[model samples]
Target: MTVDRRGVLLAGTGGAFGLYSWAAGAAAPAPKRLKLRRRHGVRPKNILVVLTDDHRYDAMGFMKAQSFGDTPTLDRLAREGVHFRNAFVTTALCSPSRASIFTGLYAHQHRVVDNNHPIPPGLIYYPEYLRAAGYETALIGKWHMGVETDTPQPGFDRWVSFKGQGDYLPGPNGLNVDGAKVPQRGYITDELTDYALDWIGKRSGKRPWMLHLAHKAVHSEFIPAERHKGRYTNQTFRYPDSMRPKVPGRPMWVENQRNSWHGVGYPYHGTLDVGDYYKRYMETLLAVDEGLARIMDLLARRGELDDTLILYMGDNGFMFGEHGLIDKRAAYEESMRVPMLMRCPSLFGPGEVSQVVANIDVAPTMLAAAGLVAPDGLAGADMLPLARGEEAPWRTELIYEYYWERNFPQTPTVHALREDRYKYVHFHGIWDVDELYDLATDPNENNNLLARPGHEELAERMSAKLFRLLEETGGMQIPLSADAGERNELRDPKGPAQAPFPPRFFRPPGT
Candidate 1:
């Protein structure tokens, strides 16, 4: 293997070198290495991260029949780059998951465990780090980090986001562009993507630029782009067998439940009758797929497709009637597991699938793609080698955490350990009991083996692993006792709150 002074490889052992050389050489000349460098590394010329709200891993076409519809663009990404099969979020809640992705920390370390919680003023976002390291940065779409009134968004030179979850169409609280709330006249997905493309198209910065295009589509109240409204309307939706109404057996924690975003029984407020909920979800996802294709097209058009590092991920997994629940904030695979994909045509081999990765690793991975050193305090490791299909035995197990949702009391604050074949969920609340699954044998997580005599020891061992991970992750603040109900009462006097569902309004159709 040989690497030139320009860091361009002349030859190598693995087929990766040939692939990269062919691709990169076919593109524009190598970006000039700048003198504005750090001890750790130099900045990438361009970075594009695309994030979707509340999307499950199975929803992608690459995931293969995990859901009802196909995501051709996402599938293309997976075929052309790396896909982390075991990618998961630190917290399944939207804001906390997004925060962890940016900070490379767990929700406990970041302390923004819920939607209502504000990002601590001192916490540095990864984009801020990029800016400090001499990269131009921009954040676009769906900044649910805080309420809308808090303006002058942090960490980005350019900012475009909504108050919370903004309407799909134009309304009073439609969209905000750099502190200005503007009435967008088209579909929210297209508008956000257009703004992101505009930034990339018009960028005059000599330094590297990091563009974060976060989408609001595929969230609740599944509204699709107008053209997509009738696309999947005729398709038959397959409901998961787990969605059937049944008693999720007791210690009362599993069986006893309250109103939830995705709950069993009658009169779910947002429930639609004209179409199956899952079908609507698939329809909503169409817009995201289209948006991704557009972004790729823009990159190709600008001649930056090969050099730019492109990342695609979901904030957290959403439940499509899995475990008789909706939304996230549970340790179940359906809620906790998210889709993660990366494409860096210059450095990494393509079409690799990594089995172990977490959303917390995203920041470090981005920094590594830019050849920058991740901050010392981050808990996530740089996963570039893993993404490049390097055969290093990475993590065999991952830790999961979900703080008690102050508004929704049905789901408990839980922590779990997921090894290659086993999963153990320990409920840190009084209402619930522990859960253990041999994922290799029981992939659906139907049978809980915690109380079974044969699996008791395995459960204990997994619990110990979870504890060690908690310590490693600075999750000492997480209470170990099974007195979660009392803890909730003590922590939040006005407890068991429900998130406010933002109202939907209309916008003019796009060209």
Candidate 2:
């Protein structure tokens, strides 16, 4: 049976003439008695997933910033929920990370490797699974998965998204509702929050609901709402110490990337000033804090505070001068790690979990919260047990893969294996160098131990493990080799090799 975009199943209703009926001669079987299992605690009847674009893990006050502005609402959420301290994304790009969260699959499995790549048409999002189990679903704010001309997949009953990254101010490039472009009148962040609250107040279902309140704030072209315009204008912002112009013993790849796309020195139009960029960035973050406050207030007023599972995360982490980089898509810690806070009063006690988890686990966790079975074929496990503080055998190491052929080519085909104490980054391209870090001793990843005599055996073991992980995850396309010619041909240096499509966008300088 087919279902319409509105989620109505297009099958015939039961009628006397319908086939496959019970035999008339069979005596009406006594109503089969089924025993219902007693639920442990109050299961959340609603879920609110608030996601921001390009938000860093350490940007909030709860993460113990030295001088950053206070994010009271987020702070409270962190205090009241189970904060995953080691949360990282499978792919550190916006679209790919979001797709991983939705599909519980890695970038290679989903085939959405970059911003311009379309999400595979047949993949089912967790919201579709939730809707199948009797829940209302709605998607608000940015949906950067693909071009807006394509119809939204059959998950949400309501959709409000744009084609790609949209501007903060209202104009022709405003948000798209369902499929029609709607001119926005106010700042995009505030408008998105307003729609989210309105939808919650007007929903007509007694069954549980899942609201995806995705925001476009804290993204590039960082512009704050008018109310937050001058909040951080006069504040003397403190830059990360790592942003210094020079650091001794830094690798050539990192030193040369000082003014690249991930670099703070890169020219971002004429509007940005190197001396004052952090001030504007802080101001832009205030709007997101305000948005969080608004969402919390709405939930409190509706008496859904204790019954809703609120999950807050960034689509991906961003870099601010770490190793002289400013954007994401790198295998480094700053770019790969994202903040994940889950507030479900019914399930988890108020505490922080330092266990490592990936963005791929988000879908199965959401499915479990809705009391539905996660579909088979997803790579992630149902993380509800972990969220509930039930100790289980978890992954000791995390695998990361980034096919770096986007508009920015500053990095290479980076395949990394990150254990608790060590990190191994294999570069499979001509333009970059391989790296290995003893994370326990060098959290900054400043030192490469690959050539060190004492670490040779350790490096060999980690390299073997990395290859094993790649083989398990179907990441064998990019081989582990240092030959520039072989690597370039394997990666198709001319353009995207897998598909015969033209380059999605031009490769900027220093990319």
Candidate 3:
């Protein structure tokens, strides 16, 4: 089915995207237009995009993460530019989310559902659009789309990347600097920043430039730079409210997940210490902030800080013991909601934007900023109008999908729909019950309202909307490919794993 999401909302990361709407009645917000209206009908000449892995929506100091202080740089951006308080990624996984950001298409459209899949050779990445428009483009670090190679892809002129999850330490296999095997001497985060700075200083581009500075820090095995190793040792790290998933109304799957590979109870088959884990994760991010500062300083030195669009986001969010899960892909808010901030001082003034945005919007927004229109089938809208608080129809709901992954098989395939105040989750290939939450009241999503009598109609409405999105996006029908030798070949071998949520929400005979 062809999904007419132009005026609506639909997005997917691994397998599906979300559909969103306002809760019941929400007065339209005032337009927040920028002062610098596209110089000569073209965006600024320089654009710097920095992407991180596993950075959650509330992880920054400005968001008031409990006991997690000292993100002054990120907080400054929130203070100086537009803060997307409701940012999310449709599929909350690394490869798929990154691909969505590059192509402006959902995971199913671009066909990179999981970490192992590759984009088709002919697919055009937005970098190609920028490069074709005479902008010098470069990609530095962590380009793990498919088959993890450091060789250059379609878009960028200069490439600096490594194999899957490049080591935090400068190992024997250093960075692949534009196809040359260059040795590394410093921390990977700092080293990556050095390469990016060098390129920014030396690039021969009178006609604008775009830099994709993707970082490898703050992923698993959180490694902090030497200077920051013990920075937070004395501070107390606070745990999430839902860290202990002993609540009665919680669904069976959420309860069972605590003992799995990605569970807080048994993280990576070792001791799971939430406090220590939080500390290490926060420490690792310190270097990322320092790197951002250096980049901003570079832009300021070149007299382009205010004029350039500097966007920061995470590829996907990480689950920090929310729903008893410690990793992404569970259709929970912790796994999907990401940090997004954009600052171009001369163009956009400081303010907070409550409109929902996603990774898929990045490509189209960048293309539009460069005075180019997105391709025909792009699933996301250019966010310039929304960012400017201009009067354009913004997203009302978000649709999300996640195909089961072989590496982490505990979590089932999922489809979800979220709006201003509610979230509906449907599990595929699992016997567990579906979940419904009134996010306005239960922001932590601790209470499940699926079986409650009074909430049935609301579930029915949300479920119907979810399936409409599924049919339109070809979400349920899309097939995944994998290697037989790798033991990742997928064919549901059990009792035709039923869609846990009824097509139109209804109770069973017993209920």
- By TM-score, the best candidate is 3
lDDT of 3 by residue, 271-314 (tens): 76867787888899999999999989987898778888889999
How would the candidate models be sorted by TM-score, starting from the highest? 3, 1, 2
| Every model: Cα RMSD to truth | 14.5, 11.3, 9.1
Q: Which candidate order results from sorting by lDDT in descending order?
A: 3, 1, 2
Error of 3 at 185 (Å): 2.1
Say which prediction, candidate 2 or candidate 3, comes out ahead on TM-score: 3
TM-score of 1: 0.82
Regions of candidate 1 where Cα sits further than 4 Å from its true position: 1-45, 66-68, 147-150, 245-251, 258-261, 267-275, 478-511
lDDT of 1 by residue, 1-511 (tens): 4322222223433322122233333433343232323435444748899999888888887666543587999998888888888788878888888888887887776666677655543456777767777788899887787434426565699988777788888877756678776787888988988898788888765778899988987887888888877666677766666665432432244433323333533214344432376677788888888888988898898778878888999999887666656667878888888888888788787766657688888887787766676666676788877876677657788888887755456677788888889998888755345888888887878777754457778888999988988876557565221221122222222322333211212235892
Query: Lowest summed lDDT over 10 consecutive residues: which window, candidate 1?
Result: 484-493
- Angstrom error of the Cα, residue 367, model 2: value is 0.7
lDDT of 1: 0.71
Give the CA lDDT, 0 to 100, for residue 98 in model 3. 88
